[model samples]
Target chain A: AQTVTQSQPEMSVQEAETVTLSCTYDTSESDYYLFWYKQPPSRQMILVIRQEAYKQQNATENRFSVNFQKAAKSFSLKISDSQLGDAAMYFCAYPNQGGKLIFGQGTELSVKP
Target chain B: SQTIHQWPATLVQPVGSPLSLECTVEGTSNPNLYWYRQAAGRGLQLLFYSVGIGQISSEVPQNLSASRPQDRQFILSSKKLLLSDSGFYLCAWSVRGRRNYGYTFGSGTRLTVV
Candidate 1:
């Protein structure tokens, strides 16, 4: 079984600053996928970024990027130029071969102006 | 482009009542469907998933069940609802393959069991 862990239960970042959310997972499988999802006040889950375990290079989507360390089984998400809209609950997820996602406890990010 | 839809943004049902949450996918075929439950301020819990029509797999044994009557439609049902079942229900769809992108989730339905 794969388990994702987000040590931080809540985080706060000043507007226009940068923030990094830590996530770690334990999985025996060699091949898998890691994802970061954002759920805003609307309660809609949106995909922030994705990283393939086979890819050594980290995944970047504009202001959202992932520091993926396959050897350490660590995938952390960094949000640059954080804005008020970035305030949401962020969840780190891992998908196995069966496409079932195991999610972390989630971190509530508060972007302060 | 693929999109997923879930109805009744919020549901309030009495205990022992039946539950039927529907999820449908558009602009895609043979995609993988999944159902997840999330307690207050918690992570998602995998309840069920379907790879194809009429095929369902249970992740955790509970009072709920799922069925895929159509290729694009997936339903989560329970004959008698429990208070523990009160949580946010999310429906997601993903392409069938390891190399495919991540899953696309619906708006999610908040079920409040009284």
Candidate 2:
């Protein structure tokens, strides 16, 4: 069974600062995809970023990036220059054999101004 | 552009009541549809998914059931709702073979079982 683990249940970041949410997973498949999703207070899930296991280069979106270590089975999300709107719940996900996503417990991020 | 719609945005039902949550996707055909549940303060859990019409897969064994009558219409139903079933329900869709693109989620439905 493929599983995603997010050790941090809650995280705090100051405005203009950077914070990294740690995520690790267990999977035997050599080729797969990883994703980070954000859910704000509105409860709308938003795709933040994604990383392909076959690609060695990390994936970066404007202010969000993922440190995907395929060998270590780690995929961490980094929010740079955090803003107040960045406060939300972050989930790390890995797809199973059937393409169904296995999500982590999630980390509640609080951005302080 | 593609869009997913799930309704009603909020629902309140008594225990043992019936449930019918509808989800529809537009601007795409033969997309993969999924139903997810999120308990309060928890991550989303995959309840069911469909690769094509009438081809539904259950990831978790529970009281809920899902049906795909049309290519873009997915429905979640339950004969008798349970208190444990009270939570947020989300509908999502993605390209059939494009798992790398991730999923596009709906605004989600808040169901409260009293």
Candidate 3:
């Protein structure tokens, strides 16, 4: 069984600043995928970024990036230049052998001006 | 372009009432379909998944059941609703062999069982 953990229940980042949301997981598979998703007030789940286990280099998507430490089973998301629109509930996800997504308790982010 | 549709947006039912939620995918064939339940302040719980028509897999042991009558259509149902079943239900679709492409989710349906 694969499980993802998001330690922070909530996070606050100032407008135009940066913030990092922590995530960790337990998995035995050597090859898999990790993902971060955002849920806005409209309740739409949007994919933020993805990282492949085989890739040593972390993945970056514009302002959203991931600090993936495979050895420690840590995959954290970093949001740069946080904006008001970035205020949402962020989820860290792991993939199961059946290709099902296992999500962690979401971290609610608030962008303060 | 592929799209997944799920409805209705909100449902309010009483205890022991029946439940019927539908999900359909467009612009794709034999896509992997999934149904998830999201409780307030909790993570998404995968309830059911289907690889093709007439094949459904359940992740959790619950009162809910799922069906895939068509390659692109998935349905979730229950004989009677429980207060614990009240939550936001989400439907998602993805390419069968390319899970790395991630999943495309529907707008989600909020169900409240009183």
Candidate 1 or 2, higher lDDT? 2
Q: Quick one: ranking by DockQ, best first?
A: 2, 3, 1
**TM-scores for all predictions:** 0.96, 0.97, 0.97
Give a tens-digit lDDT track for model 1, residues B12-93.
9999999999999999999999999999877898999999999999999999999999999999999999999999999998
Q: List the residue pairs that clash in candidate 1.
A: none
Highest DockQ model number = 2
lDDT of 1 at B71: 98
lDDT of 3 by residue, B23-97 (tens): 999999989999999998678999999999999999899989999999999999999999999999999998898
Model 3 chain B is weakest, by summed lDDT over 10 consecutive residues, at B94-103
Expressed as tens digits, the lDDT of each residue in A1-113 for candidate 1 is 57999999999999999999999999998878899999998889998999988889999999999999998989999999999999999999888877887889999999999
True contacts kept of each: 0.62, 0.77, 0.44
Measured on C-alpha atoms, candidate 2 has an lDDT of 0.94
Native contact fraction of candidate 3?
0.44
Error of 3 at A31 (Å): 1.5
TM-score of 2: 0.97
Residue range B2-52, candidate 2, lDDT tens digits? 999999999999999999999999999999999999999898889999999
Tell me the lDDT of model 1 at B6.
99
Candidate 3 is graded, for docking, as medium
Q: In model 1, what is the error at residue B3, expressed in angstroms? A: 1.5
